[model samples]
Structures are given as structure tokens and as C-alpha cells.
Target: MFYDSYLYLVDGSYLPTVAPTGLKTDLGCWKYHFGAIEGMRQNGWTLWTVILIRLVAEEFNFKLSIMGQGDNQMLLIEFTETLPEEVTVNQVNQFISALEEKLSYIGPPLKIEETWISKDYLLYGKFPIKNRVALTTSWKKNCRMFRCCNEDFPTIETSLSSLAANLYAAVASDNVTQPIFFLSISDGHNQQFSLFLVIYQ
Candidate 1:
């Protein structure tokens, strides 16, 4: 059995070609990849989801958006970063306001559904979201907040680069007796890089 998978990145970017099994005939094989495939039963492809993974820090901000119409819809935004030394009420207000404005632009009626802030190390105190009553109320109504420890999530670029490099390395090794190859492409002017790996048994 073979399968073709599509991984959509944070910036709504994706690689066009099939992955893993590299079969492009139909979506039937994908049932084994994503268990309980929703798009399969509907007779229409409706499973369009994007993963938002980022490392946030002081003066660091990122935005992501995905708009579509479907029965199974979900949008989640997460930021993992070290705790800053000091954060002002004004700063928090500004961040929330900007997030609200950005969410308004999404085509689907998608609510945040949840918002979480977790701390690690010697910080075990109440991180208040009550500074702005209106914003807090809106958040409370639309989002669920939670507290926990920080986790490390890979950025899309790092993940892609690592995957391409590893695949190339495996094919280039002496142990592989198969006639397989790969190409590392880079456009120096545009600062774009891509690795194409083709395998034949």
C-alpha cells in the first residue's frame, strides 16, 4: 500500500508533491495515515487544517490565517517562548487587541476557543488577565485559559530543512545499493533552497 500526504505550514505554505509512499493516484491510501478520515466519507475533501508552531520572545510576534468553508473546522494558535523579565499591562492589552483584530479578518466564523499561557522555572504565581476587564471578559467568554510548563516545538523551516537533509543523507549513503538520488537546489539571489529526493527500487 502507498500513501500521499500533504503538510500545510504556518504561513499557509505547503509542498505540492506527494510524500512518504509517494502515490498520487487518489486519496484512498490516506485512510491509513490519518485515522478516521473525515474527508473520505463526505465525498468531498474538507479536512483543511494548518499547524501554527512558533517560538515567541520579547518584541517577537507572528500572525497566521486560514479561511475556508467546511463542517469540521478548527483553528488553533500557540506561542512557546521564555518568560520575559517584565510585561506591562499596556503591552498585554495591545497584544490582545491586535489578536482580536486579526481574528476578525478570518473568513470562517472561527472563535479562538481557547488561550493558554504557561510558565516554567521559578515562576509559580498568578499571571493575571484581569487588567483589562472588557478584554478579559471577551476572552473568558470565547477562550479557555490554562497554565502549565513550557515546551519546545520546531519551527517549520527547521523541520523542513532537517527532513530534506536526512532524506538526502540516507539516499547518498554507501549501504543503499538501490539506484536512488537527490538534488539540493538553491537560488542564491532569491535566498531560496530546496532538496528534491527521488527513489527507485
Candidate 2:
């Protein structure tokens, strides 16, 4: 239930928390952490599997991981370690294969990666949908339905959670009395993600 929103694996070598349990708990104990990390060389299969469903369950709670990226802003997650040879370590691989299998005619694999996400990237807070934006159980991260900019927010510095909270409060005043969004940022890692409800007037 807690493993939704945007999921990522902090390259263990660089992340402050070698285990990456998050601020709420230690990594060894958190189910989400355990699901994603498998000793550094690979992770994020199950974490990715759980993202959408978790977002749909209640309010949106975002998850993030910090990894070192070069000036190109690209992150290379070596899928080399847990190659999808066996179903045991192939959870994410299976998830991707199933989805791709279904949409085989759609012209791609079921799994899609963000070309590069930057510190300055404003995820769920970038636009006031519709001028008509709608969440409608859509992941909507890279969808043209919401506005994403080519610009990047400065990774070295930010206050995204506060900003997201303010935006949510501003949007949901009447109907959704208790909508909540939880955002956790690595004080050191510089990546931010938000989970927000689209208030329908």
C-alpha cells in the first residue's frame, strides 16, 4: 500500500542511507525498500510494479531514489545483475513483459523509462490540468495531458514538498476535505517527485 507514486532505487554506493529505508523507517524493515533493492547492482522491478496501484488506492504518496548521474542527466540502472533469466528475480521483468505482450502491436515494450529526470523537474505540480487536466487513474507522468517542461529545477537546492503541499491546499478546498500527498526527498540526492489529486470543480 505504501509503495506507490514514483519509485526509484538509490545507487547504494552514493546514497547516504546505504540501505535506503526512507525517513519513515530503516530499509531492511520497509517492504518497499526490500522489494526494490537487491544489493546495489539491480533494483526497482517490484517497486515499479507497485507504483500505479498504490497511487490509485487512496491519496498519492510519492517515492524517490537518489543516484549519481553525469552531466547528461541520464541514469544507467544496470539490469545486468538480475537479468530476467529466472522468474524469482524477474518480477519487474515479468511485469514489463506482460504489459508489452498485451500491447505488442502498440510498438514497444510495456516498460517505459524517463529519458532523464532532473532535480528541477516539477513532477505532479507542474500544471493546473485542463487548464482541464484529469488524473482518472492515469500515471500521467509523461503524458501530454499534463504539462512537463524542458527546463530543470536546480537539483542542488529545492523545497518541493512544501511547494506541493501549498499547491494541493490551494486546489482542494471544498470537495476533497482530507486529500494528502507525502513527498520524501533525499536531503543529499536532489531528485523530487509528488503525488497529488486533481481537484475537479
Quote each prediction's TM-score.
0.20, 0.16
Q: Alpha carbon lDDT of residue 80, candidate 1? A: 37
Candidate 1 per-residue C-alpha lDDT over 35-154 given as tens digits, one digit per residue, 9 for 90 to 100: 444455442333322221111122334332233335432222233355353443344445545544544564222244543333221111212324232111222211111111122543
lDDT of each: 0.33, 0.33
Model 1 error, position 86 (Å):
3.6
- Candidate 2 versus the native: TM-score? 0.16
Residue 69 local lDDT, model 1? 35
Per-residue CA lDDT of model 2 for 1-201, tens digit only, reads: 246422434566433333354443343233343253344432343344334323332221223232322211122122344445353335434433444454454322233454322223322433322323343322222121112223364322234444444435444532332332222223112333321222222
lDDT of 2 at 200: 25
